[model samples]
Target: METSKETSSNLVKRYQRYLKLEKGHPENTLDAYLRDLDKLLNYFQGEGKSPLEAELEDIEHFAATVRDLGIGARSLARILSGVRQFYRYLVLDGYIKNDPTELLESPKQSQHLPEVLSTAEVDQIQQAIDLSKWEGHRNKAIIEVLFSCGLRVSELTQLKLSHLYIDEQFVRVMGKGSKERLVPISPRALDELGYWFIDRNQMKIKEGEEDYVFLNRRGAHLTRTMILIMLKQYAKEAGIEKTISPHTLRHSFATALLEGGANLRAIQAMLGHESIATTEIYTHIDTTTLRKEILEHHPRNIRYREEHKL
Candidate 1:
């Protein structure tokens, strides 16, 4: 029989290989799963119990402990998923008789809607930029593309100059799961991008970084944190009090497209969302606009009395 320590090490190795080969999980995902397993193992060790010999009660207790430690339901759900995967692998490898987490259920999570900025507010933010400086042009282009394309910060940061088809009025974006999609670029955004590109070419781009569109002072790719900082500064300068981020621009983009009568499927394709339900949140209709339309077109509302008639 394999010792608990040996079994644990072997299980970790197998999990790593499974994540790399079968799941094709990214490095960050793999790291998070590994960390979850590590916490489980440490808990087992503290109780002087072997992981291979742990019962369903031990798993439940560990989950309860995590809850008491202030871990949110979403995080707990992810940890449970990792544990279930691990146990399924163990069972397949003949190390376990049954899955310990078979009866476990994920905790309920609240669904929050995405925040969107109004067109007027968006214009206000754009107008607040100081256009005298070179960075001003670049910032404008960044904000324009963010709203026009509905790009994730990572996708925006990793965008390449080669992916732009300005003449075609479309840009190819690489989204989550490395999925690629073509998004139509508005004329105004295209003009801003063109201006920034001219300025960008004048800068001394570092080696091995020529393909990247957006770059930092060191001519490297922009970090996610920097994008957040830029949005905060822009919002402050614009005197906007509501909380906003690069993601807020994406939400605003989706909202605007839906309000403008864009097709749901077309919006989904542009957003690169695999699930239609994920794209449905952008379909918020304006009740006030609907009421005005009804009042204007209704036959009863159109009836008029003769002038000066009582």
Candidate 2:
């Protein structure tokens, strides 16, 4: 029997397991979601409410209390989402006949555009590399691949030599939830990879790690934190002040292609996005580019120019 005191804790553990094994969420995401759930459960505990005993009014009261406590709209939205997902799991398991969160809604998140580097800025960072170092070529290849392919940091770290199809002009990328897609390789990226491979082939690779694409000086695979630290170092050296990461490169790749008139669906496929909506965010990144094209090519602008004879 599930007691009121233990119900929240027990259900949260079950939800945690479900998120990990069944939903396949990454560790960081799982931890964040679990933390959100804990906050909700603890709030209910103070109100003497069990998971089953809680009503929509009770949840709303908690939301109001958190709002009064000064939780920002975006964070409160995520907390509500966590509660919503937890209740969803309960409904699925027959623990609840109706979800109390069915009528709940997340607050509208502020549209914070992702940071993107221009082609020149990207070149500036690449040129800052110390060519005398053995890792110089390797780091250059990493940057080229990141900006060219729009891969997430985890995908970049997991990249393997076997996944490269350079001769065919494509590289296989395993994205979230192990979903795989073939992203085309740019000529510049391929050239950098070639130069790096020359040094990579000579390294005393670790046993059973021979198939990895980008390894450290010790011939071991690079971690996500290492990639982040490396990007920060290069950004500082290049004299560019914008905070950046592998994801910035990824965003830059998509934004550049969009600015170059690439099809949204084509970008979506290359980025391995399951939803077109997720890929649509790139369209909102730079209205200035779109405005330029409009003024340069719009029929009204062309007619006005011809009429003015200037």
Candidate with the greatest TM-score versus the true structure: 2
Instruction: Please give the lDDT score at residue 224 for candidate 1.
Output: 64
Evaluate model 2: give its TM-score.
0.59
In candidate 1 the C-alpha lDDT for residue 61 amounts to 70
Return the TM-score for each candidate structure: 0.57, 0.59
Candidate 1 per-residue lDDT, tens place, 229-293, comes to 88888888888887787878887876776676655555555666644566465345343333233
Predicted model with the maximum lDDT? 2
By summed lDDT, the worst window of 10 consecutive residues in model 1 runs over 299-308
How big is the positional error of residue 190 in model 1, measured in Å on the Cα after superposition?
0.7
- The Cα local distance difference test for each model comes to 0.73, 0.77
lDDT of 2 by residue, 210-253 (tens): 99999999999987668878988999999989868777898887
In candidate 2, the residue pairs with backbone N, CA or C atoms under 3 Å apart (3 or more residues apart, or in different chains) clash, namely: none
**Model 1, which residues run further than 4 Å from truth?**
1-111, 276-310
